[model samples]
Target: MKKIFVVALGIMLCTGISNLQAQNDNSETPNFSKLDASPMDLALYRNQENEPMARIIYSRPQKREREVFGKLVPYGEVWRTGANEATELTLYEDMKVAGETVPKGTYTLYTIPEEKEWTVILNKKTHTWGAYEYASEEDFVRINVPVRKAPNNIEALSMAFEQVEDGANLLIGWDDRYIKVPFKESM
Candidate 1:
């Protein structure tokens, strides 16, 4: 009886240790910098009652001679948009931008940069490296937005949330160019 009890106790201890180890290994990497950057709020169906969601914001580097489109960024590639993971666009609620409605879900954000304009894509996949293996089939929505020259050069790809009368402006800027797309909550 004594031996059986001791063995059971040992087994329990081993199981507990294994569980703890697994948890440690599976823990997600901390995103401390995200807290400091301004966030782009997304509220879907404002008339309805639902919890608002938020995402940490980041932009690609806008270094000169870095090669963008057919070079650094590559014409057709799956760009992650940042250093760690793909560019992350947090959705607070289901919202509409550029005349398209996007559901309340985190998406791997990408853009096909061109001289005249850009085709921004919001894909269902989140974690990826550069846009090397981009698949259009994975895209949830694609919007064509015009780009404008910035008075001042932007050293990094930048995104900001600006308040408007009815909604907010999701702005993306890089180098000497900037683009703003309006995002409004759908009723």
Candidate 2:
């Protein structure tokens, strides 16, 4: 009886120690950075049925009381569209942009800001860090859209879809200016 009890006690003690050792190894804290200055955001365009038609993933940079266009973001230069990384646009279906039909796929969104208008570009390259390596040959579509003044100052770079009769307008606002890029449903 004593021998049996002693063996059982040894087995339980060994099992408990191993379990504790495994727990300690797995409980080590992971090294992570603090929050990003320019946080990431998502904008989705949905149909009347609440089905998502398209989505945009980008980062928002604050104006911070600085001149945005023609100064901080120079004119006639291909901007990543926002800070951090190049903007990512995913199309769920075939759509018309600037009178040209674009197929469904993911693409990097770039832009050239001007005083009167802005040229929006959809490039085949995705997961790009910035426009430093922007290739004009890889552009899938490019459209020139007129810029408009926002009613109020937009502290942060913002993007949203405004649903219209035929489709939706991608509204981008920053500082005191805004622009609309129309996306019409294809037949």
Candidate 3:
């Protein structure tokens, strides 16, 4: 009985060590940001409102001297919009994005890059790791926005919400091109 107990103890220790080694081998540091768009635009611009109406969470990836638009990201292909996990957009209230009504909720953001235009898609699926699981049939809204010329190169993928006359503009930029998706607050 004592021999069997000793063998079991040794096995447990070996398994624990193996687990520790595996963890160490895969140890990685990922910087994530809970980008609050509500305070940036909704709170500051809309004086009558006290709550944040929209937000996004995503990881930033830098361009290390590589071709971005047509090559690295590949034009005409769906991009996850950021690094690591899929970029998420959270809306606290209903809004009209490029004439399509988007109900208030969390959504996975995706984009298809083109030379002169871009397709922005809002999917019902949330917490997706990447665009690998993206399905066109599941798209809530596929809005085509014109690509604008940026003055300077943007090293990282970024989205900025700016106040517009009727509502707000979600500007996505990377490298030297950008696109603005206008949205109006509803409900």
Candidate 4:
């Protein structure tokens, strides 16, 4: 009986050791991904009731000592509004943009940048990568906002929501220029 118990114990220990070695094997280790050059960020705005009113998800790219507006981004051309993927905006409820009532939904935000102003567009399309396949006809609403000089040079692209008496404004700034797109609650 003692000899049988010893043999069984030896077999169990061997199996456990083999399982542990297999788990620690580095031969098939996964190739870990590195950090993104332009990290994605989110900005949210909540109403007085503490309910989320709007949210934006976008990648913020650094200026990196390059001319952002005209050279790096180019002028009078559609830009993804950030880096990897096109910026996405979600409205929890129906909101008015540029005096036009936009239904509550998720949309891609694209921009036609220019020297004086930017043509901000909200499209019905989502999950788009950059503005390579952007279609003008898919646009739900288009608003042209004049560009304003930033107080100082912005190293990275940034966005935020500022509450106002009527609604709120999405402030976007990068390099030395910035713009404001307003969103008002639909009545």
Candidate 5:
């Protein structure tokens, strides 16, 4: 009778341990490659009739938390706007930002963040990793924009469009900071 009780207790412990291991393995990070890739489109400006004036299509990587905004990202420095591959910003039509007119083209996007403002960059180079290899000679346009505090914190960086009377605000928000790039449609 004693031997049978001991065997049953051992079997129950082994089963419980196996079940816990299965739960941990199931919560592991998902393989993004196996998932279908969906790129998002962000419209920048609006016409007099409330139509989209310019659009930017981009794909964000799955991983986060590396040296963003301090070490890997570096404080008071330029970032390549995204991870893994270069962050691509496509201009479907001419638009104006900070008094500069940008023609329709695909450009690599970068940013320099301060506590109160951010400098948005449009570089001629389109494909690269982080800004570790960035060159000022490749810059096509640079514009300074004010940063606004977000009511709710965003874990990941996100961009969206907000309608205005004469144009649209291309808003980029992340980590409690928000920046609005005012884009006016070209007449």
Candidate 6:
């Protein structure tokens, strides 16, 4: 009886340990940092009452002297729009994205980069690792934005929301290139 009890306890302990390991498996590296190794960043825009109106969470990959468009990211393809996990966009209120109305919700952001223009894609899928499994049919809206050259080179990828007259323009920038996607509160 004592031997059987001991064996069962050992099995339970191993199973518990396995569950804990699985929980910790998916996460950022324990501890890593450097300029070339830009980590994940979160950008949030708030209203006058300090309520978050919009939020973006994405990873920034450094230039590292590599060609950004048509090479590393590959033009005419659906890029994750950032490093690591798929970029996330959360809206607190209904808004007009490039003339199309989008209700307040969280969505994944993707892009198809081109020399003259870039197509900004907002999809309903969230919590994705990358754009590897992106589906165009799942897209909420595709906004065509003109690409513009940056005055100076940017090493790390970046996204910012600048306050516009009524809402904000989401600025996506990297490697001397950028595009702005305007979003206005729905009337």
Per-candidate Cα lDDT values, in order, are 0.66, 0.93, 0.79, 0.93, 0.70, 0.90
Better of 5 and 6 by lDDT: 6
Q: Which residue window of length 10 is worst by lDDT in model 3?
A: 38-47
- CA RMSD of all predictions: 11.1, 7.4, 10.3, 6.6, 7.0, 10.2
lDDT of 5 by residue, 114-187 (tens): 77778888888877776776788998888888878789866666777787766677787766667887876656
Ranking by lDDT: 2, 4, 6, 3, 5, 1
Model 6 bad stretches (over 4 Å)? 1-36
Sort by TM-score, best first. Answer: 4, 2, 6, 3, 5, 1
How many clashes (backbone atoms < 3 Å, residues ≥3 apart in a chain or on different chains) does model 6 have? 0
Per model, state how many residue pairs clash.
11, 0, 0, 0, 2, 0
- Candidate 6 collision pairs: none
Off by over 4 Å in 3: 1-50
Residues 1-187, model 6: lDDT tens digits = 9999999999999999988887677573364445546589988877656777899999999899999899999989999999889999999999889889999999999999999999999999889988888998899999899999989998999989988877889999999999999988777
Residue-level lDDT of model 3, residues 1-187, one tens digit each, is: 9999999999999999988877667345344568733112111223135466677777767776889889888899999887778888888778888778899898898999899989999999888887999998889999888999899998877777787766778878888888987778874
- By TM-score, the better pick of 3 and 4 is 4
Better of 1 and 6 by TM-score: 6
lDDT of 1 by residue, 1-187 (tens): 9999999999999999988877667365343454423232322222223344335445355466565545766544445554444676767677787778888788877877776777788888766665655678989888877878889977666776666655676677766777766667755
* Model 6 vs. true fold: TM: 0.79
Q: What tens digits encode model 4's per-residue C-alpha lDDT throughout 1-187?
A: 9999999999999999998888778786565679899999999988877789899999999988887888999999999899999999999999999999999999999999999999999999899999988999999999999999999999989999998866899999999989999999887
lDDT of 2 by residue, 1-187 (tens): 9999999999999999988877667457455679888899999999888878889999999999998999999999999999999999999989899889999999999999999999999999999997987999999999999999999999999999999977899999999999999998877
Q: Quote model 5's TM-score.
A: 0.68
The TM-scores of all predictions, comma-separated, are 0.63, 0.84, 0.73, 0.84, 0.68, 0.79
Q: After best superposition, candidate 3 residue 125: deviation in angstroms?
A: 0.9
- Worst-scoring 10-residue span by lDDT in model 4: 23-32
Cα miss at 122, model 2 (Å)?
A: 0.8
